[model samples]
Each structure stands twice: as structure tokens, then as C-alpha cells.
Target: METGVHPARQPGCHPAHNPRGKPKRPTGRTDGPSRKIEVRALAEELGATLIRAVRRDADDELASVGTGHGPVTISWYAFALEYLDMRWPQIAAKTRNETNAALCAITQVMLRDVRGRPNDELLRRALRDWAFVLPRPEPHAAPPDVRLALRWVARTSRPLTDLMDPAVMRAVMQALRLKQDGTVAAPETQRHKRMTFVNAVRYAIEQGMLDSDPIANINWRIAKTAKRVDPRVVANPAQVRSLLCAVSYVGSYRRARGRRLVGLFAGMYYAGLRPEEAVAVTLPDCVLPAEGWGRVILHVTRTQAGKKWTDTGQLHDERGLKGRPPGETRPVPLPPGLVAIWRESIQTFGTASDGRLFFNERGGILAFSTYDTVWHEARQLGLPSDLVNTPLAARPYDLRHSALSTWLNAGVDPAEVAERAGNSVEVLMTKYAKCLYGRAAIANHRIQALLDEYD
Candidate 1:
């Protein structure tokens, strides 16, 4: 058995029936030092002879199992925690948040009884934000009620063996599938949850607690996940330009809340930068010369995973590039219009102490709520009545879709677009660059002396 996971037979299984079927080092040899114990008095009571004493100590069965730390005695919550503890150092902050969320959903249904349970919402908060994650900021300082809720959970949570029961597994499946409102979860979310749960079950099997993985024995399928960006959400250039114009009008000229984000939005629309990448852009990353195409070399992303999950205890964490290695950079060509915008932005806003091009009024990282409100207002203000009701420019990220699809529609080479967009050529062609239907066809109309000739 792996170290620290006490070898246990839940109910039906033995060490010999361990999932790996590699015989456990005959009992007490696994966790710590083993020693010989003569059982002459006990053997005499059982009418056994002394001739078997000459056999190797390794051949003897363990006199007793682990003291209270075995699977039968451990709660499912504790087992799941141990699984996460083993995995913590191997995963990123965002992944840790995701794992915490998945386990929270699974844990809600892992209770022994609800006889004296606390409010469901409060219990979930205690699990999701505090108890499930470690290195938490001042863990002992959790609010009194939250501490009480956690204690209640530890007292009422079912044994790890309950996770193997078919009925409990079905409840777990249901909890993972539907939200509290009874709506089906997103496919990717459901898949993440199942993957986390399966890993926990496999941990049990690895510790010689189970004959097989319960999740593997069950029949279940996650709904299909989407790979390609929806073509409908990809805004074209004209709509994006109008939206940028409207965004500038969002707040009073003095506050400049909406005006501050104009250049930020332009980067995504003109250069295909992701929202997180655009937020982290610093003055040093840009090169805006007098006339021609400028350049922006990308390095990091400042993204949100909540203060509790982030190592910095801030709403956002600055991390390495999404799919690229540390310090690897992607260079994107900037248009002359964007260069002019950048020059104006630097003069007007002056940048944060760290040279970030855009920030909140207090010169801090931009919150999602702030930008989302700005974008929602811009859609209403910029789009035509009919178009506003549609999905055009629905999200700030769609400006990037607008940029990349415009490149593809304008017949740019796939490899070149991929390089500029920081995507593999396959992803550029299949996911990011789906051509919009109307942009090219309605671009212009010619005037002729005879209208029939044009038709």
C-alpha cells in the first residue's frame, strides 16, 4: 500500500483482493517498522501448537488493523481531503478552485443524516471556501458560525465506505448533474466534477481499501463539451468599432470609467488578445511608433479565481501564459489606429505604478463586474434596435473573435493568424476563426447608370 494510506478492507475486500492485486507486504510492514509478537498464551487458548513458531515473521497475519485511521473509521470528507492534499502541490490555483467546487458538490450529499444539519447555504460556504482548501489565510480565524458549521459536518459526515454504495453513488451523480435550481450543469463542469470524484475513488483503491473503483464500475456519461466558439457570438468589425465608441460615453467625462477601457477593448478587437491578457498588458509590452504597424509582446495573464483560492488573497492572480511555458512570449502586430489609441491612453491615464495601461479609478486591477456593466450598457447604446436584441458584440471577448474571424475572412494565412493569436494552427482554424456570414457580403454597393447591369 502507498505510505500514509492505511491498508484497510472496507467490508468485502482483502489485501489480496486489492485493486492492483500486488500482495501487500504481509501486514504491519507497510506504514512503519514491524516487530515480532509471541502469542503463546493466546495460541494455547485456541488449541494451536508451537511448531508454527519457526515460520518467518513475514508469514504471520497482522494481529490487529490500524488504530481508528482505517477507511471504515475515516469519514468520506477526510478521505477526500487527503486526496486533495496529495494533489495540492501538483495543481494550479484555478484548478484547485475547481477541485474545491467539485468536492463541495459531492460533499453536500455525503452526509450521514440531516437530523441537526445547519442551513444548506452556510454549510456549502464553509466547505467550498474554507475547509476544503489549505494555506487558507488565517484558517483559525474563521467566523464562529462557520466554525460551528464545519464541526457539524465533521460529526455527521458518512464513513468512506458509504461512497461505495450504489444508492449513495447515484445521489452523488445527481448532485453533480443538476444545480440547486434543478438545471443541468454545463458539460465541462460536470466532466470536471466526475474526474475529481473518480480520482478520490482511485485513491481509496490505491490504499488497498477497495477491490475496484466504484466510479469505474458505474455507467454514466457526461454531456458533450464544446470546442469551437459559437459563430453567433463573434461580432464583426463595424459593430465592434461602434461598441467601442459607445463604451467611451458610458460614464461622465470626469469619472472616465468607460473611457478608461476603450484602449483595453480595442486591443482585443484589433489584436485578438484575450480579456485576461489584455488586462495584464503593461506599457513595456507595447511599441507604438509614429506611423506603421506597432508590436505587443504578451507574457502573463491576471485572472480571477476569488481571494480565498488565490495565493495573494486578492481577487485576481498574475500567472504565466495559458498554454505556453514560463517566460515564452507571443508577439502580435498592432495596427496604426491602435498605436494612436495607445499613445493617447498613456498621455491621459498615465498608467499604474507597475505600468499597466488600464485600471480602476483607484489604479487597481479592473473587476469583472465593472467591465461587464460597461459592456452591457454599450450594447444598448451602440447597437441598432434590431441588432441590440441579437447577440452581436455580446461579450468583450467576442471582440477577439471579431478580430480573428476578420483575418480569416480577409483571407489571411492560417499559420500567420495562429502565430499572432497565440493558438495552435489547428485551434485557429477550427475554434477561433469561424467566418461570420454578413460582413463581406454587405461591405459595399456600387452605383451604376443602369441598375440592371449591377444586378
Candidate 2:
């Protein structure tokens, strides 16, 4: 039989009496120290003892089971680092950043209530900006504040086993639903965080740390997502043409920034290329004819995820077309007008060194900010004052929206529209549903004709 006394409480461990000659209590509190300090110290000791006991029991159980593998006693922070390492080579830059962000968010609620913990803001920043980017080669040590906060998190984070508890999982879900400012997060943001967390838990299950993903058992309500495109932002054909013309007139006396981007904007309006896809259009991608309609074979997109997210530290990452497999191509048929625009652009500006059709004056990739500034200036120059301030074609992306809407409204088959827009039929029907103007009147007219024939 063993006594409940810790090793520190052994008979010869310490003097039985205090310096003031008071007898030391078995509970180990002395009357000398400040109460707050004593309480904090006691809490720290208790936390450490509890952690050690839990780990020891887990180890003992594994040994009894006769398995060679060690117990799953990793901290949440350590597991997060391991998971990111496992995933880094396979995922896209944007996805990598999102994974890091989601893990950082989860870390906030996964810590034990340790004394002397860093403030919430500091800890969050440290996790997101420093601790979670495990794959990156450290250029330098983190700042003192971030390093301190990171150390606190490493010391205080709950073990991976804690995530198996329903209550702890519930806390994580609640944290996912809120922004750093404590306001409700956007629906998309909530969805992304939940998806990342669920995937992480799934990975945990595969690693034998969890029996099942606790998130699957949780009865949580996800905010409904808004699927339809706002009609106000959809530009009509005439408006798009006017905008394209206005783009030519912008900075005409300067570096011809607007002139250089005309074909790029045309690709968005007529060929329905995403801004990223348009930026990446090379000479080999386009099938430009002198007179008739041409086609663009889009194989890659140059998406601008910040340098820290990309493996190369480049501002843009060259990835497969959005939602498409690597090396798969999407061929979008361009209208004759767009073909004319492309021909003129190629003749005037020529291609970049790497054969990309649209590039800056220095032949580098066109920055999104540069094009956005030109588009805004073109809007002010082209649109009527009232329309200029409204959401009509507010973003370069809105142009692609308008193009899809136009194709749908023109009685083009939904399947064809979806293929051209590089979207699923379901997404085309759901997102661009409201933007398909004049469809209601056409449906009403057809109904009226049928009713008249019956009469």
C-alpha cells in the first residue's frame, strides 16, 4: 500500500518548520507568502501534476495493451504543427493560409486555464502569424512579445485527448462562429473554419488519437449561405461595352495602363475568364482568328495569395483553374468582338517574355491593384454619375458575373453557360439565378400564349 503523499512531501524533503518558527502544514501553504502568489503557485503545481498523471496513466494503459506504439499524449499545439507539416506539400497556398488561420482560431479555446496566461489578442496573433506556419524556414526569431505568448500557449494548451470531450468540442464550435472582435463571423468564414476543424479532427481519428470526429456528433446550426448574385452588380451588354471603351481612354497620355488591359477586361466580359485566369493568359492559350470568333484554352490561374502563403514566396501562385484538377484545361469560346480586341492588343503591346498576353510596362505580371485602380477610373469616366456610385460592375469579378448572367438571359442552355463559366450546373443555377433578367417576362409570355390557345 502506498500513501497519497507526493514525493515532495517525503519526510526529509524540506524543514518541518518555517523561518518564523510556525509548523508547515501538510497542504504546503505557509502564512508568509502573499495569498494571490500562493494561490497562483498552487494552481500551477496542480495543473502540472494533473497533466503528468494523465500522461502517465495513458502510457501505462498503452504498455498493458502490449502495443509497441506510444500513448497519444500530444498537446493540441504540437498536433496542429504535425498536421500542417503533413498537409503543406499537397494543398494550395490559399488553402494553406486558411488552414493555419483555422488552427490558430481553435488554439484560443483549446488551452487550459493556466495562471499567467497571455492576453487573448497577443496569443491569437502569435499563433496565426508565428507559431502555426510550421513549413516555412524561419528567417528570424519571432519578436519578444510573440515568442513569450507562443511559449505560454505551448505550456498551457490542452492535450489532444481533451478534444474528444463534447463540452470541449462545443466550445471550439462556439469559437469558430465568432470573429476576433466578438461579433458573429460571416457565413463563409464560419463554414471554412468548421470545415478545417472537421478535417483536422478526421486526421486525428486516422492517427488513432480520436475514436471519431467529435464535430460530427455536435448538433450545431450553420448560418444559411446567400447563394444568389446581387442583380445590382450585373452590368448589361451596353454598359460593359462602354466600360471597355472608357478603359482605352484612361491614362492614354501616360504608360497606357488602361489600353494594355482592354483585352483582359474583354476576356472577362465576353470569354467569362476570371480575373486571375485572364492575368495568366499566355500566347499559347489563345486561338485568335483575324475575323471570326476565337477560343481561349485556360489551363492555369495565377491567384495572388500573399508571399507568406506561397511556397515560392511569390505574390501569385500558379495553380490549376479553380475547382479543376491539375493540368486540366477549360476552353472558353470568345465572341468575334473579343477576338478583334485580342488581335489589336497583341499587335499594340505584344506578349511578355514568358508569352503572357497581359503584363505591366516592365513585363512583370499585372498587379491586381493596378487593374482595380484602372477599372475604378474607367467606371467614373464611363458610367452616368448615378450608376457610377452604385454597385453596378463594382468589382472586376462582377464583370464575369454579368457575362454569365448575359449568357443565361440570351436563352443559352444552362449546361453550356456552366461549361463556359467554368462552374457546376448547380452553382450556375443557384448563384446566377437572380441575375438572369427578362426570364420572368419570357416565361410569362410563353404561359400566356399557351393559355390563349386553350381559350
Candidate 3:
């Protein structure tokens, strides 16, 4: 028997429409998979009229055998908008962008059918740039092509109920694992996207749409992200000094392009400060003196989260320290050399309008590109040709890594290192475990000294 929607009125009709008063209930088990044609699917086949038929006939067996109807629908696209609106105020700008990126990728799979779908590129832009963001543009006000793409997504987005199907979740997994171009995303990227999806579905469960987290049921394993810092990027103190010296030679003397960042990068090397943390340092945060050592009371990170994503309307987001709550502070000891650099930076370049120690000549937050370009040039000038092409201090962040590793190799207590570096001990040990081996020669020397005394 060919089992599909029928062209003519089927056997399982109620008394209202059929000349036959009411058809007898079908004999087979109603719970079986073959028994139901979901009213939405039936509506697709028979047009809107089938919905009225499903609603009018409340007979469970007959309706189950013909059109399975339950309730009115909320498309996933609209629900996702609502989900985002609820979450907007609470999260930081970076987190908001990250969540949106995850959801934007998942949107490709959440769509119902591709019938009459607009261009893939157009659809993606409409969703990512507008629909996923908190304040969506009015449908009419959107660009003509964007309006069409948004409308298509609105029309064809699958209902929240459809997630009960395991196959739907498998598609979501594929979306998380792959980029829009169908290439594999990085392992950390995959993990981050999955985390966002898990949170979204948890919201669905809270709304009573899902019985449990579908992610809990799925067995998909993403690739493991490396926690350890790459040893190739680590540079010794002497190399770092040479790189800092080289930064001075970049750009004209008046421009002072590379000169502005020497103190900032040195903070990363000597204090194990993240670039963002270094950027946020102010006069109040520093305890520089004509002394042996100083301390920087770190409290915040000023990193770019883009104007589109942030509530502040500024391109840079002034956010609390990573892994620490707002208003909490970390105090890092600064060597006398770094203290002199700080003093000089304050006296020569002066502070930004906000009192931050480092800023562009225009008195704006330093653009990442300026520092990155300067650092690349500095590497070329300062390092030998063999090392310039290598991974050694390739990123300015690697200076912080060098600081942490140097501290670890110097036999500093791991707990103290973790506290100074603003990391948990477990994480610090895991990340710098390979770098810790450099201290073995010193340990051997001490052991040899003891053995010689015994001899």
C-alpha cells in the first residue's frame, strides 16, 4: 500500500464534512510511528484547509490516523530572537558576539525546508548581522534582498518541537563542527559553539518545549583543545629586551609609533599581564616608586568587542578581569626596570584622557593592529633570521607566556605564580608544565653539590 497524503478525501473523516456521518476509529495501535501525519505536514500537502479539518474533528484515533494537530506554533527563528532578547543585558559584548556566532551557524540547520530559499550568502548576512542581534530591524525597513531573506527564514524556520527528532540534533552537531564554507572549525571554536547551543536548548527546556537537554543524550565528541602553551613561542629575558629596543627604531621619531607600546609589551613580559590588562593600567593602578620593585593593582581589561556588539557604543569594551568577577582585583609585582619604564611612559607620553598609561598619539585606546604591526617589525629587526621566521614571540601575548614560564623555571612557588598570573594553580601547571623542565639543570647542580659533600 502506497502510504502518503491522499488527493481525494481520505477514509478517516469526521461527520461535519463527509456525507458519511462519522468513520469508525482505525483498528491499529495509535502509538505506532506509521499512524500519524503531523498537521503541519498535512497542511503543507492539503493547504490551510486541512488545519480546520484537524481542529474540528477532535476524535483522537481518526485525527491521529489523518492529521495530527495539537497547538499553534512558534518558529525557532522567532524563539531564538526572544531567547536573545532575554539574554542581551546580562552578558558582556564579547560573550554576546560569541553566542550570536554560535547561533548564526546553527541557524543554517534549524531551517525547515530550502524551498524558495533566497541566496545562501544573503540569508546568512540577514540572520547574523540583524536577526541574531537583540534589536532587529523592522521587516519593511531592511534592504530589499535582506527583507526577502529574513522573510524566507521566518517562514521556513522549524518549530521548537521538531528538536525531539535526534536527526535534527545531528545536523546541529555538524553545524557546530564545520564553518559556513564546510571546512572544519577549530576545536575550541567547535566547543564554544556547542556550549552556546547547549545553553539555548536549556532555555527551551525551561520554557517546557523540551523534556531534557538533547545534548545530554547525544554522544558527539569534539576534538580536544590544547591547554599547554607552545614552547616554540617562549623567549628568554635577553631576547625580550632586544625586541623592546628594536620597537624604538620603528616609524619616524615624531610619530613615536612603536615607542608608545614598548612599556605596554614590557608589562606583559615582566608582570605576566595580558595585553588587555596592560592596556587598562592607570596611574591609580600603579605603585611605581624610586625603589627596587613596584606593584600594579589590576582590575579590568579593555579589549575590542566592536561597536555593533557593545552597549557602550565604543569599539572597545572595558570589562572585568578574565575568570574573575567584576570589582575584584589582582596585584602583580613589577620589577624596578618595568617601574622605570612606567615612570618614563607617564612623564614622556603622558596618560590618555581616561588616565590609562598607554594610548595612541591621538589620545585614543591603542588599536591592536598598530601594536601587532609594530611587533612584527620589531621581531624582524631584533631576532636573528632563523628566529624571525620561527614561532618565538610571534604574538605579543607570548610575552606573558614567557613571563609565566620564566617564573616557573626560576623555582617560584607554583601557587604564587598562579596568583600573580591571575590563573588557577591547576591551569597554570597544565599550561606551563613543558616549560618547567628548564629548571632541571639547576636542580641537578644542587643535587651534585650535596653528593660532592657526601664524597
Let me know the TM-score candidate 1 reaches against the reference structure: 0.77
Local distance difference test, each candidate: 0.78, 0.84, 0.83
Worst 10 residues of 1 by lDDT: 56-65
- Model 1 steric clash pairs: none
Best by lDDT: 2
Pairs in clash, predicted candidate 3: none
For residues 245-336, could you state the per-residue lDDT of candidate 1 as single tens digits?
99999989999988999999999989999988999999998898989999998999988778867777899878888899888888889999
C-alpha RMSD between model 2 and the true structure:
10.2
Error of 1 at 50 (Å): 44
Residue 27 error, candidate 2, Å = 40
Q: Give each model a TM-score.
A: 0.77, 0.81, 0.82
Runs in model 3 with CA error above 4 Å? 1-70, 442-455
Q: Ranking by lDDT, best first?
A: 2, 3, 1
In Å, residue 348's CA in model 2 sits off its true spot by 2.3
